[model samples]
Target: MSATIKDVAKMAGVAVSTVSYALNNSPKISEETRRKVVRAAEALNFRPSGAARNLKKRKSETIGLFLNDLGGPFYSQVIEGVQEIVASHDYNLIVCSTYGGENSSAHRFLREKFVDGAIIMGTAISDSLILQVASESFPIVVLDRELRGDYVHNVLITNEQGGYDAVAHLIKLGRRNIEFLSGPSAAFDNTQRYEGYKRALLEHDLPVPKRIAMHGRFLEAGGYQAVKLLLASKRLPDAIFAANDEMAIGAIRALHEAGLRVPEDIAIVGFDNINLAPLIRPALSTIGHSKFEVGAIATQLVFNARKEEDVIILPTQLIARQSCGFSGGVSEQDHDNLVASILHVGGRTKH
Candidate 1:
């Protein structure tokens, strides 16, 4: 059997409390006594229990990060940003996926306070659960969702304005019959982008499509299938705005297979300027934002050490690449225009 603290105490001819104080380097025990206890522990190969130490201090020195899934290139930068902050503070980062909702290990971590604080990035975890668990002592930083609570800080992306600008750009290029390819209806980001799509059409006096594509998986395959179905309808829109780059890439593939040309026959735009967006043929016009900054800011909020409810909304930029066939790329003048538009929309400045 393995040696325990009792074994060390007996071996050193000292009390169990003396053994603990010696091991923990308590000042109550003399340096000579500490050395003697340490020698005994080393002889017996006695190691302290981390769980016991944590229970004593009431601290784990760990941070929990809840994500939808660790798929695609989207989370790499976010994780890096989070790691940068976590490593500096000497804290361990535990990333978990909420793929199974309440039954998932991630949800259990949230419910049980497995870490000192939490950074939530997905909608799989319910709002009620978050509100119930968040307290003044146990703060939470949520990304892309707006939920008000005593110690909940929300870090949001400027989705609505980004969406508006993307669709408005298409409308200005004379693509009136624009089709909005959407993700899950309940998704906050998706809903906000779709709202911008509708607003652009309404502002320009264009008829919004009575029926639109819905329930995208926000993956490449989901984009492909949605476009294929739209093609079958025999009514193709002049422009397609996917809620994300993956879906837009999928739509391009579907259109290519059907012998339709991009921008010449149909224009396309996407959100989230993922790395793959620029590498793809014809390139993808996308709404770009600093995902790394989002992760970093959210983590900083977790360590704010106050009960003030804070909200940080990161600004999004419109990247005009080859797909939209507008200007092929954004010029300095266009960048100036983008800043003006963003200011007009909500006065959000970059961090």
Candidate 2:
């Protein structure tokens, strides 16, 4: 049989009300008496029910972290940032990937008020649903998308600027025939990035080759397949700008297998500056931002008491490596030394 609060009170030689106050850390009880009650409860192996405590306090002290999918290295750093902030705030975080937004668990948790708030990063959950559920009592913070509601806040990266900088760097390297490997058509980030790419090309009076603009789906395999299709067409561009680093790496592998060299035959640039970008051969020249900061800031917004809708846009910077053939007229050794020096000086390049 399980020990009850009465048993703890009896064991500690205290009244039932005194036991309650002690266990709940009420100021009405002395510290010494609270310690005594706690010791008795521990000795009796009395575990307080979380559901009961939540009901009494009317606060779950938990938050939900919703993602599109859990199978990428990109999410790990973001999760770390969220976890750090949530822990510091004395709240538990539940991570759920909706896998295209059909996750019953996510739906249940949100509807049932199992969490105090949610930090949502996936697109599967419709904006209508978020708007319906978000109230002043149940605030929500959305990442990567712009959502406006009384209780909703948005945290997003400057994806358009990142995309523009990436393409502009390629154009500055004298590559006019630049191809863009796009991500999913439904993704807002992809749309913004493509818009930026188009804007840069238009500014430079470069032709936007509609035929070469292929979808990479933001995956390595997608990039590889897209490159294969481009090769099959027998019409290659002077350079390619993949929407993400994973696609860029995949394109590099595919180009190498087809007896083409990067930055010589076809220069390449990518966005997202993922961890593997620097480690890869002919290190990726890409747009970089702190995914960790994005996660942390989003989580913080969820906890904020401001009822008005707000938007936070994080900035991004361009990271130049060897892949884009922009050595600035320096020798290969000198360029490498310069890159090392930049890294040592704490520039945007990832370690």
Candidate 3:
């Protein structure tokens, strides 16, 4: 075999444990000793065995990224941001999908010590599982979920602020009688958005129609159906605020089919500021968030918790666009700028 930690230690005239401490950059080891150990390791062509190091330290050094589904623009980008930092830190990661219910394999993995820590995607990972993992002293960073206990660190966006901003934007556009197409009633995000919509309406002394604030499944079809349900009553709201971009797109398509022009007829707003929001006709106006930053922060949290640290909360912003009567990013030049934006920096903000 190539040179091992033992060989590096022997060559450096130090204990194997000392070599490990130095390699890990542990504070206990002196910098001179660390340099000498590294120098010897290089001379001997020594490579740290992940298996051996984990066994010695009792840490897998691999973070588990568990989500309800691996597909979707949100998760895809979130994973990208997580991977970017994780690769730099010399930490391996295991991607697990808990889709279609509580995955017995994942549950087993968590209980059996399969990872150093976990980065959970929003509310996809259940509260029951959260409790179960915490019982075993598992370090977890939960995203998008309002649930938290002593051990679980929550990394969340202000869903309520996003919701309020979207609706409030429509209100500023002289559109009143706005209806909220919400996500699943039990979803924390849905509740927060619903509360925001209600708060905006109440602040403006707008009538809160009991039936107007209908529930959508955070999908395109859900938005279509929700709008159709309201349309069947012939009491159409002046504007619609969907909890997500997909639902809003669906609602817009349905409205188009009915010969209702967006903004000119009925203004619409969407949450998430997804990629598709600015691609289609009339280019959807949406409330934006840094999913990449959220993922980055969550990944950082997992790393910190692996070494034992505190939790964090990130912020959100509103993105004005065409469909919601905002002047930003409706034209070709803005689109080019947006694409150019992707090439520049991290947490890449766009128009």
Candidate 1: what lDDT? 0.85
What digit string (tens of lDDT, one per residue) describes model 1 on residues 1-351?
889999999999999999988887899999999999999999999888988888866788888889998897888878887888889898899998899879998899888988889999879999999899898667898888889888998989989988998999998788888999898778899989999989999999998888766445788899999999989989888899999999999999999999999989999999998889889987889898777677877888888856878888878878888788966446434755765565346444433
- Candidate 3, residue 312: how far the Cα is off, in Å: 3.0
Model 3, range 1-351, lDDT digits (tens) per residue?
Answer: 687778888899999889989999999999999999999998988888878878877878788888766665657768877887788799887888875455544555676768877887645556777667763336787777766564667777778887887777788888897888887887777788888888898898887777545667887888988888778878787899998888999889988888888988888888877779889788888776666666777777666654233445444567677787775323434534553454245333221
Clashing pairs in 1: none
Poorly placed runs, candidate 1 (over 4 Å): 1-49, 328-351
> Which ten-residue region of model 2 has the weakest summed lDDT?
342-351
Using all chains and alpha carbons, the TM-scores for the candidates as numbered come to 0.84, 0.84, 0.78
Residue-level lDDT tens digits of model 2 in 24-100: 99999999999999999999999877877787788899989988878756788788878878998999999987863
For candidate 3, the lDDT comes to 0.75
Error of 3 at 20 (Å): 10
Worst 10-residue lDDT window for candidate 1 reads: 342-351
| TM-score (C-alpha) between model 2 and the true structure | 0.84
Query: Model 1: how far is 21 from its true place, Å?
Result: 5.7
